[model samples]
Target: MQLGLLYSGGKDSTLAALVLERFYDITLVTAHFGVTDEYEHARQAADAAGFEFRALELDREVAEEAVERMREDGYPRNGIQHVHEAALEAVADLDFDAIADGTRRDDRVPTVSRAQAQSLEDRHGVDYLSPLVGFGRNAVDRIVDAELDVEVGPSEEIPRADYEAELRAVLAEEHGEGAIREVFPDHDQTYVHGLRE
Candidate 1:
Protein backbone atom coordinates (compact mmCIF):
# COMPACT_ATOMS: atom_id res chain seq x y z
CA MET A 1 0.00 0.00 0.00
CA GLN A 2 1.12 3.52 -0.66
CA LEU A 3 1.12 5.60 2.49
CA GLY A 4 1.40 9.37 2.68
CA LEU A 5 3.33 9.98 5.87
CA LEU A 6 3.15 13.52 7.27
CA TYR A 7 6.81 14.19 7.95
CA SER A 8 8.47 17.11 9.70
CA GLY A 9 12.03 15.82 9.58
CA GLY A 10 11.85 15.46 13.35
CA LYS A 11 12.66 12.36 15.34
CA ASP A 12 9.12 11.12 15.86
CA SER A 13 7.96 11.64 12.30
CA THR A 14 11.17 10.29 10.79
CA LEU A 15 11.05 7.26 13.04
CA ALA A 16 7.40 6.68 12.18
CA ALA A 17 8.25 6.73 8.48
CA LEU A 18 11.01 4.20 9.05
CA VAL A 19 8.69 1.85 10.91
CA LEU A 20 5.87 2.16 8.37
CA GLU A 21 8.29 1.48 5.52
CA ARG A 22 8.44 -2.16 6.60
CA PHE A 23 4.78 -2.63 5.76
CA TYR A 24 3.99 -0.06 3.09
CA ASP A 25 5.55 1.95 0.33
CA ILE A 26 6.21 5.12 2.32
CA THR A 27 6.08 8.56 0.76
CA LEU A 28 7.28 11.28 3.07
CA VAL A 29 5.01 14.32 2.83
CA THR A 30 5.96 17.58 4.48
CA ALA A 31 3.49 20.43 4.62
CA HIS A 32 4.96 23.92 4.49
CA PHE A 33 2.78 26.67 5.89
CA GLY A 34 4.88 29.59 4.83
CA VAL A 35 8.37 30.45 3.67
CA THR A 36 10.39 28.14 5.86
CA ASP A 37 13.32 25.75 5.62
CA GLU A 38 11.49 22.62 6.72
CA TYR A 39 10.87 21.39 3.21
CA GLU A 40 14.57 21.16 2.45
CA HIS A 41 15.33 19.53 5.76
CA ALA A 42 12.52 17.04 5.29
CA ARG A 43 13.71 16.28 1.76
CA GLN A 44 17.20 15.59 3.07
CA ALA A 45 15.83 13.35 5.78
CA ALA A 46 13.81 11.43 3.22
CA ASP A 47 16.88 10.99 1.11
CA ALA A 48 18.79 9.70 4.12
CA ALA A 49 16.00 7.26 4.85
CA GLY A 50 15.73 6.21 1.20
CA PHE A 51 12.08 7.16 0.87
CA GLU A 52 10.28 9.18 -1.77
CA PHE A 53 9.64 12.77 -0.65
CA ARG A 54 6.96 15.29 -1.49
CA ALA A 55 6.41 18.81 -0.18
CA LEU A 56 2.91 20.14 0.02
CA GLU A 57 2.57 23.90 0.21
CA LEU A 58 -0.40 24.73 2.33
CA ASP A 59 -2.48 27.77 1.48
CA ARG A 60 -1.47 30.92 3.34
CA GLU A 61 -5.04 31.35 4.45
CA VAL A 62 -4.66 28.24 6.58
CA ALA A 63 -1.81 29.76 8.56
CA GLU A 64 -3.59 33.08 8.81
CA GLU A 65 -6.69 31.44 10.16
CA ALA A 66 -4.73 29.54 12.76
CA VAL A 67 -2.91 32.66 13.85
CA GLU A 68 -6.07 34.67 14.04
CA ARG A 69 -7.73 31.97 16.06
CA MET A 70 -4.75 31.79 18.40
CA ARG A 71 -4.89 35.52 18.93
CA GLU A 72 -8.54 35.29 19.84
CA ASP A 73 -8.19 32.22 22.09
CA GLY A 74 -4.98 33.48 23.69
CA TYR A 75 -3.49 30.01 23.28
CA PRO A 76 -2.28 27.75 20.53
CA ARG A 77 -3.74 24.50 21.75
CA ASN A 78 -6.65 24.61 19.36
CA GLY A 79 -4.93 26.67 16.71
CA ILE A 80 -2.24 24.07 16.13
CA GLN A 81 -4.83 21.35 15.86
CA HIS A 82 -6.55 23.35 13.17
CA VAL A 83 -3.31 23.59 11.26
CA HIS A 84 -2.76 19.85 11.65
CA GLU A 85 -6.17 19.02 10.32
CA ALA A 86 -5.50 21.34 7.43
CA ALA A 87 -2.25 19.54 6.72
CA LEU A 88 -4.01 16.21 6.62
CA GLU A 89 -6.74 17.64 4.45
CA ALA A 90 -4.17 19.12 2.12
CA VAL A 91 -2.95 15.64 1.24
CA ALA A 92 -6.37 14.12 0.79
CA ASP A 93 -6.09 14.44 -2.97
CA LEU A 94 -2.91 12.36 -3.21
CA ASP A 95 -2.99 8.87 -4.62
CA PHE A 96 -2.40 6.91 -1.48
CA ASP A 97 -4.20 4.24 0.47
CA ALA A 98 -3.46 5.86 3.80
CA ILE A 99 -2.24 9.01 5.49
CA ALA A 100 -0.13 8.90 8.63
CA ASP A 101 1.38 11.28 11.10
CA GLY A 102 3.83 11.03 13.98
CA THR A 103 1.42 12.04 16.71
CA ARG A 104 2.37 10.09 19.83
CA ARG A 105 0.38 8.97 22.83
CA ASP A 106 1.62 11.91 24.83
CA ASP A 107 1.00 14.57 22.25
CA ARG A 108 -1.58 17.11 23.35
CA VAL A 109 -2.11 19.13 20.22
CA PRO A 110 -1.94 18.22 16.55
CA THR A 111 -3.45 14.87 17.45
CA VAL A 112 -6.33 13.36 15.58
CA SER A 113 -9.13 12.41 17.88
CA ARG A 114 -10.69 8.98 17.40
CA ALA A 115 -13.75 10.62 15.91
CA GLN A 116 -11.68 12.78 13.62
CA ALA A 117 -9.64 9.80 12.46
CA GLN A 118 -12.77 7.87 11.66
CA SER A 119 -14.22 10.86 9.86
CA LEU A 120 -11.14 11.17 7.68
CA GLU A 121 -11.21 7.51 6.74
CA ASP A 122 -14.91 7.59 6.15
CA ARG A 123 -14.88 10.75 4.12
CA HIS A 124 -11.64 10.31 2.19
CA GLY A 125 -11.68 6.59 1.66
CA VAL A 126 -8.21 6.38 3.12
CA ASP A 127 -6.84 4.98 6.32
CA TYR A 128 -5.44 7.29 8.99
CA LEU A 129 -2.50 5.91 10.94
CA SER A 130 -0.37 7.08 13.79
CA PRO A 131 2.34 4.51 14.38
CA LEU A 132 3.58 6.26 17.53
CA VAL A 133 0.17 6.66 19.09
CA GLY A 134 0.74 3.59 21.25
CA PHE A 135 4.21 4.68 22.27
CA GLY A 136 5.01 7.04 25.08
CA ARG A 137 7.87 9.51 25.20
CA ASN A 138 10.19 7.07 26.94
CA ALA A 139 9.47 4.22 24.56
CA VAL A 140 9.83 6.50 21.57
CA ASP A 141 13.12 7.86 22.89
CA ARG A 142 14.39 4.36 23.47
CA ILE A 143 13.44 3.35 19.95
CA VAL A 144 15.16 6.39 18.50
CA ASP A 145 18.21 5.70 20.57
CA ALA A 146 18.39 2.07 19.56
CA GLU A 147 17.45 2.34 15.92
CA LEU A 148 18.77 5.68 14.63
CA ASP A 149 21.51 8.25 15.15
CA VAL A 150 20.14 11.78 15.47
CA GLU A 151 21.11 15.23 16.63
CA VAL A 152 18.69 17.23 18.75
CA GLY A 153 18.31 20.93 19.47
CA PRO A 154 15.84 23.52 20.60
CA SER A 155 12.78 23.51 18.34
CA GLU A 156 13.27 27.14 17.41
CA GLU A 157 16.86 26.55 16.42
CA ILE A 158 16.12 23.56 14.29
CA PRO A 159 14.42 24.32 11.00
CA ARG A 160 11.87 21.65 10.18
CA ALA A 161 8.50 21.93 8.53
CA ASP A 162 6.11 22.67 11.39
CA TYR A 163 2.94 24.67 11.79
CA GLU A 164 4.21 25.99 15.07
CA ALA A 165 7.21 27.64 13.46
CA GLU A 166 5.05 29.88 11.33
CA LEU A 167 2.59 30.46 14.12
CA ARG A 168 5.31 31.32 16.61
CA ALA A 169 6.99 33.64 14.18
CA VAL A 170 3.78 35.52 13.52
CA LEU A 171 2.94 35.69 17.18
CA ALA A 172 6.38 36.93 18.13
CA GLU A 173 6.39 39.56 15.45
CA GLU A 174 2.85 40.78 15.88
CA HIS A 175 2.24 40.31 19.57
CA GLY A 176 5.80 40.08 20.85
CA GLU A 177 7.75 37.11 22.18
CA GLY A 178 5.69 37.13 25.32
CA ALA A 179 2.71 36.20 23.21
CA ILE A 180 4.56 33.14 22.02
CA ARG A 181 5.32 32.21 25.60
CA GLU A 182 1.71 32.75 26.60
CA VAL A 183 0.28 30.70 23.76
CA PHE A 184 2.71 27.79 23.64
CA PRO A 185 3.81 27.81 27.28
CA ASP A 186 6.99 26.14 28.42
CA HIS A 187 7.72 22.89 26.67
CA ASP A 188 10.81 20.88 25.87
CA GLN A 189 10.75 21.45 22.14
CA THR A 190 13.35 19.52 20.19
CA TYR A 191 13.99 18.68 16.55
CA VAL A 192 16.21 16.25 14.71
CA HIS A 193 19.24 18.17 13.49
CA GLY A 194 20.43 15.28 11.38
CA LEU A 195 19.60 11.65 10.85
CA ARG A 196 22.72 9.57 10.98
CA GLU A 197 23.51 6.11 9.70
Candidate 2:
Protein backbone atom coordinates (compact mmCIF):
# COMPACT_ATOMS: atom_id res chain seq x y z
CA MET A 1 0.00 0.00 0.00
CA GLN A 2 1.06 3.55 -0.63
CA LEU A 3 1.56 5.43 2.62
CA GLY A 4 1.71 9.11 3.38
CA LEU A 5 3.89 9.66 6.44
CA LEU A 6 3.70 13.08 8.05
CA TYR A 7 7.29 14.29 8.09
CA SER A 8 8.94 17.18 9.88
CA GLY A 9 12.54 16.65 8.75
CA GLY A 10 13.20 15.48 12.27
CA LYS A 11 14.75 12.25 13.39
CA ASP A 12 11.49 10.76 14.62
CA SER A 13 9.61 11.30 11.35
CA THR A 14 12.59 10.31 9.23
CA LEU A 15 13.02 7.13 11.23
CA ALA A 16 9.32 6.45 10.94
CA ALA A 17 9.60 6.65 7.18
CA LEU A 18 12.56 4.28 7.22
CA VAL A 19 10.73 1.81 9.43
CA LEU A 20 7.68 1.76 7.17
CA GLU A 21 9.45 1.79 3.83
CA ARG A 22 9.99 -1.96 3.66
CA PHE A 23 6.32 -2.65 4.12
CA TYR A 24 4.80 0.14 2.07
CA ASP A 25 5.62 2.61 -0.64
CA ILE A 26 6.24 5.60 1.57
CA THR A 27 6.06 9.31 0.82
CA LEU A 28 7.51 11.78 3.27
CA VAL A 29 4.89 14.49 3.45
CA THR A 30 5.39 17.87 5.08
CA ALA A 31 2.27 19.83 6.03
CA HIS A 32 2.41 23.60 6.11
CA PHE A 33 0.05 26.57 6.30
CA GLY A 34 2.01 28.84 3.94
CA VAL A 35 3.18 30.85 6.91
CA THR A 36 6.77 30.25 5.92
CA ASP A 37 9.01 28.50 3.42
CA GLU A 38 10.38 26.08 6.02
CA TYR A 39 8.70 23.14 4.35
CA GLU A 40 11.54 23.12 1.87
CA HIS A 41 13.80 21.82 4.65
CA ALA A 42 11.69 18.70 4.89
CA ARG A 43 11.79 18.23 1.13
CA GLN A 44 15.58 18.42 1.19
CA ALA A 45 15.80 15.98 4.07
CA ALA A 46 13.48 13.57 2.26
CA ASP A 47 15.57 13.77 -0.87
CA ALA A 48 18.72 13.04 1.09
CA ALA A 49 17.03 10.10 2.76
CA GLY A 50 16.11 8.70 -0.64
CA PHE A 51 12.36 8.95 -0.18
CA GLU A 52 9.63 10.42 -2.30
CA PHE A 53 8.53 13.78 -0.93
CA ARG A 54 5.43 15.93 -1.07
CA ALA A 55 4.09 19.05 0.58
CA LEU A 56 0.57 19.06 2.03
CA GLU A 57 -0.75 22.58 2.17
CA LEU A 58 -2.86 23.25 5.23
CA ASP A 59 -5.50 25.93 5.80
CA ARG A 60 -4.27 29.27 7.10
CA GLU A 61 -7.40 29.53 9.24
CA VAL A 62 -6.32 26.51 11.20
CA ALA A 63 -2.95 28.10 11.79
CA GLU A 64 -4.65 31.17 13.11
CA GLU A 65 -6.84 29.09 15.41
CA ALA A 66 -3.84 27.23 16.78
CA VAL A 67 -1.95 30.44 17.38
CA GLU A 68 -4.88 31.91 19.25
CA ARG A 69 -5.24 28.81 21.37
CA MET A 70 -1.58 28.85 22.27
CA ARG A 71 -1.81 32.49 23.16
CA GLU A 72 -4.76 31.84 25.46
CA ASP A 73 -3.27 28.81 27.16
CA GLY A 74 0.27 30.23 27.46
CA TYR A 75 1.41 26.83 26.29
CA PRO A 76 1.50 25.03 22.97
CA ARG A 77 -0.05 21.72 23.99
CA ASN A 78 -3.65 22.24 22.96
CA GLY A 79 -2.79 24.33 19.94
CA ILE A 80 -0.30 21.73 18.71
CA GLN A 81 -2.76 18.92 19.33
CA HIS A 82 -5.32 20.79 17.28
CA VAL A 83 -2.92 21.22 14.38
CA HIS A 84 -1.77 17.61 14.56
CA GLU A 85 -5.30 16.28 14.30
CA ALA A 86 -6.02 18.58 11.41
CA ALA A 87 -2.81 17.55 9.68
CA LEU A 88 -3.72 13.91 10.10
CA GLU A 89 -7.09 14.52 8.54
CA ALA A 90 -5.46 16.42 5.70
CA VAL A 91 -3.08 13.54 5.09
CA ALA A 92 -5.89 11.03 5.16
CA ASP A 93 -7.66 13.06 2.51
CA LEU A 94 -4.87 12.19 0.12
CA ASP A 95 -4.86 9.18 -2.19
CA PHE A 96 -2.67 7.04 0.01
CA ASP A 97 -3.99 3.80 1.45
CA ALA A 98 -2.31 4.44 4.79
CA ILE A 99 -1.13 7.47 6.75
CA ALA A 100 1.40 7.70 9.55
CA ASP A 101 3.19 10.08 11.89
CA GLY A 102 6.22 10.02 14.13
CA THR A 103 4.63 10.79 17.46
CA ARG A 104 6.41 8.84 20.18
CA ARG A 105 4.84 7.09 23.16
CA ASP A 106 5.82 9.72 25.68
CA ASP A 107 5.04 12.80 23.64
CA ARG A 108 2.70 15.01 25.63
CA VAL A 109 1.23 17.05 22.80
CA PRO A 110 0.22 16.27 19.27
CA THR A 111 -1.13 12.94 20.38
CA VAL A 112 -3.91 11.10 18.61
CA SER A 113 -6.13 9.30 21.01
CA ARG A 114 -7.34 5.83 20.04
CA ALA A 115 -10.81 7.11 19.36
CA GLN A 116 -9.51 9.85 17.12
CA ALA A 117 -7.39 7.38 15.19
CA GLN A 118 -10.36 5.07 14.76
CA SER A 119 -12.54 7.90 13.61
CA LEU A 120 -9.96 8.98 11.06
CA GLU A 121 -9.62 5.48 9.69
CA ASP A 122 -13.37 4.97 9.55
CA ARG A 123 -14.01 8.27 7.88
CA HIS A 124 -11.11 8.21 5.46
CA GLY A 125 -10.98 4.50 4.60
CA VAL A 126 -7.25 4.51 5.26
CA ASP A 127 -5.16 3.03 8.01
CA TYR A 128 -3.69 5.45 10.52
CA LEU A 129 -0.33 4.46 11.93
CA SER A 130 2.17 5.83 14.41
CA PRO A 131 5.26 3.73 13.97
CA LEU A 132 7.07 5.19 16.96
CA VAL A 133 4.10 5.22 19.31
CA GLY A 134 5.44 2.21 21.13
CA PHE A 135 9.00 3.44 21.43
CA GLY A 136 10.45 5.56 24.19
CA ARG A 137 12.81 8.47 23.66
CA ASN A 138 15.90 6.49 24.67
CA ALA A 139 15.18 3.78 22.17
CA VAL A 140 14.50 6.27 19.42
CA ASP A 141 17.74 8.05 20.17
CA ARG A 142 19.66 4.83 20.00
CA ILE A 143 18.27 4.07 16.58
CA VAL A 144 18.97 7.56 15.37
CA ASP A 145 22.51 7.42 16.65
CA ALA A 146 23.13 4.18 14.83
CA GLU A 147 21.24 4.77 11.62
CA LEU A 148 20.63 8.41 10.79
CA ASP A 149 22.55 11.61 10.16
CA VAL A 150 20.67 14.12 12.30
CA GLU A 151 21.59 17.53 13.64
CA VAL A 152 20.41 18.26 17.16
CA GLY A 153 19.82 21.73 18.59
CA PRO A 154 17.31 23.97 20.23
CA SER A 155 13.91 24.04 18.51
CA GLU A 156 14.27 27.68 17.50
CA GLU A 157 17.57 27.04 15.79
CA ILE A 158 16.84 23.69 14.21
CA PRO A 159 16.23 23.67 10.48
CA ARG A 160 12.99 21.74 10.40
CA ALA A 161 9.59 21.95 8.75
CA ASP A 162 7.44 20.87 11.66
CA TYR A 163 4.15 22.58 12.39
CA GLU A 164 5.72 24.20 15.41
CA ALA A 165 8.06 26.20 13.18
CA GLU A 166 5.26 27.44 10.94
CA LEU A 167 3.05 28.09 13.91
CA ARG A 168 5.86 30.05 15.53
CA ALA A 169 6.27 32.11 12.41
CA VAL A 170 2.56 32.90 12.33
CA LEU A 171 2.45 33.78 15.99
CA ALA A 172 5.53 35.96 15.72
CA GLU A 173 4.23 37.81 12.67
CA GLU A 174 0.82 38.48 14.16
CA HIS A 175 1.61 38.81 17.84
CA GLY A 176 5.32 38.99 18.57
CA GLU A 177 8.30 36.79 19.36
CA GLY A 178 7.49 37.25 23.02
CA ALA A 179 4.09 35.62 22.53
CA ILE A 180 5.62 32.52 21.03
CA ARG A 181 8.41 32.42 23.58
CA GLU A 182 5.83 32.48 26.31
CA VAL A 183 3.96 29.61 24.72
CA PHE A 184 6.96 27.49 23.76
CA PRO A 185 9.73 26.93 26.22
CA ASP A 186 13.22 25.96 25.28
CA HIS A 187 13.38 22.41 24.03
CA ASP A 188 15.88 20.38 22.05
CA GLN A 189 14.91 19.48 18.50
CA THR A 190 16.43 17.54 15.63
CA TYR A 191 16.81 17.83 11.89
CA VAL A 192 17.52 14.73 9.89
CA HIS A 193 20.15 15.06 7.18
CA GLY A 194 19.78 11.50 5.93
CA LEU A 195 20.61 7.91 6.76
CA ARG A 196 24.09 7.65 8.21
CA GLU A 197 26.91 7.14 5.76
What's the true lDDT of residue 89 in model 1?
A: 86
* Candidate 2 residue lDDT tens string, 1-197: 99999999999999999889899999999999987899999999999999999999999999999999999999999999999899999999999999999999999978988998999999999999999999998999999999999899999889999999999999999998778888999999899888888
Prediction 1 TM-score vs. true: 0.89
Q: State in Å the error of residue 103, model 1.
A: 0.9
Candidate 1 — which residues are off by over 4 angstroms? Answer: 172-178, 193-196
| TM-score of every candidate | 0.89, 0.98
Q: Candidate 2 at 89: error in angstroms?
A: 0.6
Among residues 3 or more apart in sequence or in different chains, the pairs in candidate 1 whose N, CA or C atoms overlap within 3 Å are 38-161
